[model samples]
Target: MGAVIRYTTDGSDPTESSIRYTGTVSVSAATTLKAKAFKSGWTPSQTATAAYTMSISDTILFSPASGEYHSEQDVVLSCAVPDAIIRYTADGTEPVESSSPYTKPVHISETATLKAKAFKSGWSPSQTATSAYTMSISDTILFSPASGEYYSEQNVSLSCNTVGVTIRYTTDGKTEPTINSMTYTAPIAVSETTLIKAKAFRSGWNSGTVAEGNYKLRLPDCITFSPEPGTHFSNQKVVLSCSIPGTKLYYTLDKSEPDKKSIPYTEAISVSETALIRAKAFRKGWSPSPAAIGSYEMAIPQDCIRFMPAPGTYTEAPTVEVSCECGIPDVVIRYIINDSGSEDTLYSSPILLSESATVKARAFKEGWTFSNISQGTYMLKVKEPVILPGSNTSVTQQEVQISSETPGSAIYYTTDGSEPAENASLYDKPFSVSQTSIVKAKAFKIGWETSGAVSEKYTIKAAKPVFSLESGIYTGLRTVAVSCETPGAKIHYTTDGSIPSKASPCYDSETLVSLSKTTTLSAKAFKENCEPSEETEAVYRLKITTPQISSDAGGFSCETAEIRMLCEFPDAEIFYTTDGKMPTESSSVYDEPFLATGYVTVIAVAYKPGWEPSDAAVKHIAVKGDINGDCSADMSDVIAGLQILTGTDSAPIRSDYDYSEADLNGDGRVGSAEIVYLLMAISKK
Candidate 1:
């Protein structure tokens, strides 16, 4: 029979496959064993035994393979069974099963310790295998916020233990965590009523339950008022109010709380003076609202008045009327007489006076006063009566005289019917009237009767002079003998336009005068101290006549070959010829007077410069020929003899040029032609 095998080693329970021996195994002196067995059927039924030391490997073991645990979680203890049955104690004790089979791995709520051992069937338990399994509760399934609860849309943080664990959360106050793959770091935003939940999960570990948190949604605090700021009011009717969402509002005016019956606005509030007001509002879950302040300054009513008066001279009566202006009610007026230092009350009445004075008027109210005075003197005098002119009508071509009744009094007059005064010119003499004239006059003087006036109407007959001028011929000098037909009068004349005076040159008896050319002769006649006659019509006439020729017989010079025939008329034309013959219309006309020349036979004729020649006067001019007369003799007598011989220089020779008397020869040409007579006279001698 085989030995019944029941063995244990290394403080472990023996098993069927544990190393078994049938013979007595040898036991060395060491604490180790060689093969030792107990056999019932071997070798004649001899009972042999051997002793050997058993060996064990050093190892540690655990009970469950893998599982989950919160922080501080304790678990049961166990070890690998081989050579011994094990007993364990977690509280630092030796192995013993009576310590209650490690009651389901002591549910450690926080981090805890674990220890275990193995015992053979008959050997004392080996050294206890010890271990400390910490129930490391991870930061898994981090709630949105770590500690305090918060409102919706409030920021929160979520965290996890595993590296890639997806966390989801909801704010709707539900236990279900929302499925959102977000890393648990920063706070999450939430809005409505919410249940903040978080879960941590990886691919291998079991998914976690929802970690729950609750929150309520709320709105931001606000406060508002009606009838907004900066509003104007004519009559103060103002409404004030305030409101805010999600909260009740409390208000105060002048730092007093408002009630239901309290007035929030004022109507018909009169502001006579400035005012300072303040108001405020408040609400919960928000900061306090600022106070509303206002200030106002009222305006005053405007009223003013102005007055003016005309300017005038002293001693002249000037009337001034008063005008009133009142902007508000209950305005009264009072005046002070500046001339007499007296005050007078005027209730819509004019103040009249009888002397020169300055008047000052003042407007008054219950609280105000205005003093305005006239700038000029107001004079009072008796009204003066006006005088009327005596004559109102006039006549033509006659003299009408209007005179003032008193001398040295100014007579005001006008033809246009306007106002007049003593400053106007005084009337003295009658006006010599021509056309029909209307005249008015007034006489004025101080301290005299103002109404005693005189006027009259008169007519006079027209007297005129008519005549003709008997114009005489001009001799190249300005002179005329004029005659008129007006009877019983003396004639006055003027060459220029000047007033005819007694000293003016007069036209006397028939005078031989010189004149230039055509001219107008003007003249008038008047009886002494009588009205002058009208001027006669102008006489437009031309004068044509010859001037007398004269010479100085004693002033003749021997070198002077020709004699000059001088005339008094500067404008006359003098014509001359060499032959001793009278000039006719066919003779050469002289543009200018003849100049004295040597031995020239000049037949000089005097006439107007442009008119036909007058009768010529023959002159026998010779160089110093007038020994007794001191005058020259010209070729007139010489050419006369030459004409007697030639028979053409002059048809009828004068006795002065006869060769029988002058030639001394039987031949012509005077003395030269009679040389034979002289020689014969000598020969006879």
Candidate 2:
């Protein structure tokens, strides 16, 4: 028997040849078959290929041919032949006809392995293919400084592992993963809170869900100070903390970032002066936290106290108060009075006064003279009163007097008379008084009753006259004038040097008495009710035989010459001189009138010696040129002038020529025509 091959073709087959059979075939109705046989060493045999209908089973399978995908990544699986049908199941099961057919690429949701097969009618099930598709997780989450860590400004790299996957990320958690990601490089300063996420993707693959991370951005550790910024401090410290949790604290007072070796905060610290402080809190993969601000001031003790006093003056005993309040509570108060004189303490107590003497006060403490003698006062006392009365009756013009009833008893009297006492009467000499009347006086004794002063209204008189001139030898040629004065008395006087009697020449007032011979003058006065004062005399020492000249008969011009003779002393004989010599009896006397021509010297001498001589006197003369006696010279003088026509040089005009005789033309000056007329007149005479 030969085996029979039975196959059905509905355009779904593995091989390209048509279905073939051999030998006999039994077939159901509605089936069509064609057959062929193969025999060895002989011609092929043909058999009856019957047309019979038979049922064939069809299977479906689905798979991801490109398997093992990251989450939400695309995958593809194919059927065995073009006529085969494909289906898929996400539950990792064989696909049935009811499942959706794999008409396009499939996507893997998670890590998965899938089986897929092809199916055709009247064909054996295709060999099952196992495909491993894995949904990869985006395990590489880019974390800056981690969430609970403190970090300073630093760089961090972010990455992920997934084949054919493009990554997208967000730091603020506001964006999803995509091919275009808002990415950043390393060295992100963690100055604030930040969130990080990433996703993976490729073509024909869905983007993976974003993986998230939390971190806190932090700044560098910094130290701050109150009241002063940008300053350094020594032994300074600050509180160390972080913006994130579970971070270690570290600090340095220098200007360096804090490290593990830096000092950690446990308690408060004392800062002496300026210094820098830095601190940082850190954890794994996180930036360090910033430092805290710090400031401090130390307490100091006071040094010393000082005081000063204002300036002032002291006239009498004076006290000034000063105070010092400073550093310490208790202080020593030391003072010196009159440091220039003595540095001894005047008073340690509160009261310090300038005594009756000049003094300066100073304050000293702790090697310092805080208060100086910038001002002071000198004390002066009033002098005692000096009593000046020396007599009880009338005080001398400037003298005062006091009287005592008993010896050694004091007398007191006030010129003002304000009081009377025993202690007031030590009079010194040489006092002055203005009044001419008496002053009040009283006498007092300690045990005896005070005696009343004999009050007499005694008058003060003017000083007596003292004679200044005395009897003396006499000069013979000069007259003497005498004078005398008695201040309050009228004086009477005589020239005989006799004691002045009531009948002597009385001078009711000051007078000058002239005398020519030796004589005596006596002066006296009577003060009120006092004795007549003695006489005062000044002798008249007169000069004898004094010469004199006649002031009226001295000289005139020759035209009007009229000579006169008179004595200087009408009571004495006189003489004269013509040749400018002293005169004697033989000298010519002026018995006649004469004419003069030019200046001539004439001297007159008194007949007695010891008298003054007259100074040599000169007379100027001129010719009378007017020949007419009409007191004028006009045409009427020509008839009289022609009568004396002589040629004599001594001719006179009408023999009685005067200044009018020379005035021929009625003019005063003399000329030659007047002289000719005078010569003619002289010739006529």
**Candidate number achieving the greatest TM-score relative to the actual structure:** 1
Stretches off by above 4 angstroms in model 1 are 1-323, 336-348, 352-360, 368-519, 523-537, 540-584, 587-685
**lDDT of candidate 2 over 1-685, digit per residue (tens):** 4533334423233121446643454542245554444434545444434445433333333433444444465666654355676656666787666667667777665556556566555444455555666555545554544455444443445565555455566666677656677654444454456666667665654455667766655544443333443433123443444455556767677677668788876654456554455656666654555556443432112222232223333223345553434332333444444465554554344444433323344334442224433223333221122234433322134554443324544555555444545565444343455444444556544433345554333344433344444456543433333333434555566767678766777654344555555666666665443345545666554433344332222121223333334544544444555454666657765443444333233455443333333333332123333344444334444444444444444433444334443455655544557656656655654
Supply candidate 1's per-residue lDDT for 124. Answer: 43
Q: For residues 1-685, what per-residue lDDT tens digits would candidate 1 score against the true structure?
A: 4555534333344444546745564432223332223455543322233344443334446543234554333454544545444455556565565654543555544333455665454344546566654433256465545534332246666776645566765554544553454345567665444566666654433456667655554333233333333322222433444454443333333445443233434332233334444544444443444555544433222233333444343334335555555444665655666545555757465555445566666556553334344334464322232333343332134455555434344565543344445554455555554433334456665533333333333322123433333544333345555554434556666655454555656655465223345544556655543445566544334433443443332222444432455555556656667676676546776554444543335576766644444445655444222212123233443444445446564334434432232333324335434333334433544
lDDT of 1: 0.46
Report the Cα lDDT for candidate 2: 0.48
lDDT of each: 0.46, 0.48
